[model samples]
Target: MCEANAYLIEGDDKNLIMEAVDTIEPDGDNLLICNIFGEQKVVKASIHSLSLVDHKIYLKG
Candidate 1:
């Protein structure tokens, strides 16, 4: 329930990358995201901002 949805931010657009992301781990120059359903994704991006109230995690690539 504390998990947050992940987004990739580009200029004025925000793209949803993953939902219900349970964990985010650093992988060299990339990030490893794991969802509640066991789905995983590796993205070459950096953390931009976090909206705890909205349960959102934004990243910049």
Candidate 2:
């Protein structure tokens, strides 16, 4: 319930990367995201902003 969905901003569009994201770790220049379902993704992007109220995680590549 405390998890958030992750998105990658691409110009005028926002792409959903992962849902129910439970953990995020800094992996060098990239980011490592892990969902509650144990799904993992390594994205070459940076943290753009976080909307806690909206339950959203925004990343900029």
Clashes of each: 0, 0
Which ten-residue region of model 2 has the weakest summed lDDT? 44-53
TM-score, cand. 1: 0.93
What are the lDDT figures for the candidates, one per model? Answer: 0.94, 0.96
Worst 10 residues of 1 by lDDT: 45-54
Query: Which lDDT tens digits does candidate 1 get at residues 1-61?
Result: 8999999998999999999999898899999999999999999998889997899999998
Q: What ranges in model 2 sit over 4 Å off?
A: none
Q: Count residue pairs with overlapping backbones in model 1.
A: 0
lDDT over C-alpha atoms for residue 61 of model 2: 92
